[model samples]
Target chain A: MTGDGQSQARPRFEFRRNTWILAAGFLALLCAVNYFLQDNFFEPGVMVSNLTTFTPLILIAIGQTYVILASDIDLSVGAIVSLVNVVTVSIMHHLGGDALAVAAGIGAGVATGLAAGAANGLCVAALRFQPIITTFATGTVFAGLALWILPDAGTVQAPEPVWRTYSASFVGVPFVIWSLGVVALGCWLYSRSRPYLTLMAVGGNIRAAFGSGLPVMRTRIAGYVICGLFCSLGALALTGETATGDPLIGIAFTLSSISAVVLGGTALSGGVGGVLGSVLGAILLGLISNVIFFAGTPFEYQNLIQGVIVLVALAGGVFVSRGGAR
Target chain B: MSAARERTRSGPRWYRHSLVLTLAIIVVLFAAGETLSPGFAAPGQVIYLLVTASLLGFVAAGQNLVILGGREGIDLSVGGMISLGALIAGNVMDASNAAILPALLATLAGTFALGAVNGLGVTFLRIPPLVMTLGMYGVIQGLLIVITRGVPSGRAAPMLSAFVNEPLVLGIPGILFAWAAFAAFVIWMLRSTAFGLRIYAIGANENAAALSGVAIRRTRVLLFALSGMCAGLTGFLVLGFSGNVFIGVGDQYMLPSIIAVVIGGTSLAGGIGGHHGTVAGAIVLVLLQSILTTLNIDPSGRAMIFGGTLLLLMFFYGRQQRLRV
Candidate 1:
């Protein structure tokens, strides 16, 4: 089994080698820039806050990595976040915000995310809808359902103990750090799993994978399911941060996650990237935003600069990878 | 036999006959509207629907060209182009109508230049059309924000407003005449010209067309430029209609334009549809909106319906082909 796995993964590892290196180097550079620009960037408190800010996007980008690696895309992840956030918050609110209610709400939110992912997966992998447009349409549907559930943004304070546990540290280590550790470990383990390789194989060449006796449809569907699960987790993280439910909160996640995935050196063409790069990519994006904010750029020009930088980063990543391949 | 072969070659049996489906849908939507609200079938209401549909139709015309140019061609920047065009034209036009022509020309030229950049990125740099146009959307949006400082200040030129709103013939708006002429021109360009033929050939199969001597790069560039110009023109029209320009004036049209093209039976896979169907599509969408509005559906419900409809349409049209383009 080890030999079989090694043989199957070798070609992909070769394709992905330089991207991981580039992503790591770029992430380090971004962190260094942020440290210099931010007066207290190295403080544990500041670092914890930054990590908290980075956590949701990191999770979403990881989920997105699976879909993109399978040569499919999910524009509806943001909508799933929106839906799950609303559903969780609403449930907690209706249940009077008790500890048990909060637990139940969290479970419901995860279920909503899984359900949305399953819908998208069925449409793309089974029903044969175009991935981009299908997801775009489904995103609208999810967003609408969210709006229906909560017609307006509302604040529902979870029981004090819930958020306290979230923000609080166990044994002088932050809960966020523990959460990140668990997430990272989970991703690492999954990366080495057979299903991950199957997804990569399916994405690299659907016909070839099919010929090689891979369950192409199931692999693609599983990618979406995994993505949905991560998006729900991101939604939960967002709930912890905001303690509020807004149907519109996750609108920015779709493009940002896609950008993070691309910036992480994952080819949009699929089959040649990993979750670790996406984690760094999400951090790099957050750090870039922070650096821009701290550098005293006018508020209006910030969006412009960010847009230009993302385009440049995208173009640069594409150029470097192409050159390396040649 | 040759004719039959050509028909089969062009598209699937249902697609070749999709115009009938579109017309039938439009008729049904109209009937639904009439049943829901007695005033809906009135001539004034019909004219209103046509005028609104004409705006989307113009944008769809350009979008059809880009989508038809193949290689997964799409332009997400249409909304940005429309906004930028309107902003430029609105700012340039003083109370005096004299500034209108120059403003219109400048808007066209500026937007075309931007579209050319998208074309270059897609064709030369090998950026996927999706990412390239999305990036262009961001750049245009950011530039507009910076230039306008989050507040747009300008009134529509008097002449433009008059042309757009005033009745030119038999209680029909003057804009209808302009729309009619533009539609005629687009139809001619797509069907009766060498450029049109090349667009079809390239959309059908890029490598095959290129090998057969089609100027793939130039045609693609022109296609995107044309999409930009159409968006620009819609911008000016929108300014005339609203008598003002704002940051997000073009936001609503982007998805609707794509929906219009797809409804008209133009394959997202490229090379298998035409502008006429898009025209019908725009009308159908407008009529659908009218019906939805009359039924008093909330905005959220409307969004769900719109998305659900798009999914159903795609499933119907796309399921025939198993291979993902």
Candidate 2:
């Protein structure tokens, strides 16, 4: 985030200032290619299905954007998701799967996630443990706890109605879309709040923000807290989609969320980006895989192609972000 | 002249004692495990633990260098490299004893090249080392899938397995001997070589190191490549230890490698840790695993205890050095 591109006022220059635009441009191009390749890409049903599948990533990226905005990284999101998912499902199993049981299970999951985030915040911002290792340690702990709680996978699931609700639509709009709308709206509202600006200032220059009397510590904690909450929410969506509890479920999402965050135009060093681009970034990542799938790539080679493209997207952001470095 | 070498080899007295402290903890923990389980202190069990330790030692050695090189240095692709190395070793040797040397050279050189690409992306392309290696990790996974055509197959030559498991002398496994030689070479390189000082300088202050004419970019790339080679060695070791290959075999080594380095008291911020401590660190981790298993604590509980211990260890080591004004 340090010594990045200079701020420019013109529309053309503004395009360079916003690296998310790169993600957007790529997403559009991919969508176009995908649309031509897949006959049903634009169909309402397929669109709804794709949105539901990708919503969790978008949500996690949004959360990650907050932490990265404050120049901190959370490696524990995937572990938190696993913990929250298992905790939710196990609680539902204990409570006999009633509606009230579902509500309590979700509440417990979210609360547990928030607590984990606060602990990460305390370690990094207060105790001054290095963010990467601290989170790695905590992630191991959280994943361990998840394995303890649900030693066996697929033995517990939220009731059928939960998945039903996730699969169902309201007024011709999918539940996932509505949830995404609320999330996007919430992010927009938070962007206008004092804490959001405080986080931005802290990320842009920590000593300067501290010198300016900003409550840097609290804002940093809040960033991690928000990240934890969103991760838990993403877990909830995952639970609904998979409808089962598995300790190993989140192993892949940890890095994928980081990829989505970086791909969205947010600087890895933090500051100078928004959740909007992250949302697009997450969608862009989803689309890349989608495009690859539609392009008739074999299942074996899909991962290789995805990895190459993700690297390209990262390199794409470099020309703009590294301008000042050169 | 001997005193000067000693000072360079061990650094200040305080740094030397951290190794002693870690060894002391190892002894205390071993004693505790023996008290809990009668056979825990037996040469057989201890040797097995050490055999396990050496496999991880190879990885931590590489991790030790990259972390020492600084700039948020971490090799997320070690797991991938290990898997790739294992697969390549398996395919080239194709169960033949005669091809072992070629397999060894090929695995090291191949993984080092891929690791160099990790370096090129990180330095020349200005990609963050963390993400660059991460993407490479996925790429390696994809490569694994493509090469095996979905099912992993191959066998270690009989001698290779014997080298890993059978005692070479004094009831010591050949792998341990291999580990001792590797550790000595790495320690020598770190203490005696000009590149060692350059690594410390760059980790401490990149701009100042650059201003002082240190080849920061080249050194970092070389360091990453070395880390890759280390992971490649781990893969080779794993193939011998297990007698075959498994999909994603190296994935489990990822966290333990870093944990070994950090627990060895190597600073995560870089420049302040060494491979000597990491040997004890690897032993400490294997001991933890063995002790936890003997206590009848399940894997989850073992993980929790390991993580909890790691957090406590962080309380002692790797915090950003606070300057006293």
User: TM-score, each model?
Assistant: 0.93, 0.94
- Give candidate 1's whole-model lDDT: 0.83
Please tell me which predicted candidate would have the highest TM-score against the true structure: 2
The sequence of per-residue lDDT tens digits that candidate 1 reaches over residues A1-326 is 11211123444446555575677888788778888888799899999999999999999999999999998999998999999999999998889888889999999999999999999999999898878878988999999999888888865555666677779999999988998899989988887889988998887778788888888888889999999999999999988888888998898899889878877777676776778778888988888789889989998898788778777776655544343432
In candidate 1, residue A44 scores what lDDT? 94
Give DockQ per model, in order. 0.38, 0.47
DockQ of 1: 0.38
TM-score of 1: 0.93
Q: Which ten residues in a row have the lowest lDDT in candidate 2 chain B?
A: B1-10
Candidate 1 lDDT tens digits, B1-325 = 2222243246567776787888888888888889888889899889988989988988888999999888788888899989988888898884459999998998899988988988988777777677778778878888888988898867788889878777778999888998888888876776667787788777776776777787788989999998998999899888888899899899789878987888788888677777788899899889877787888999789879977987887776555355432
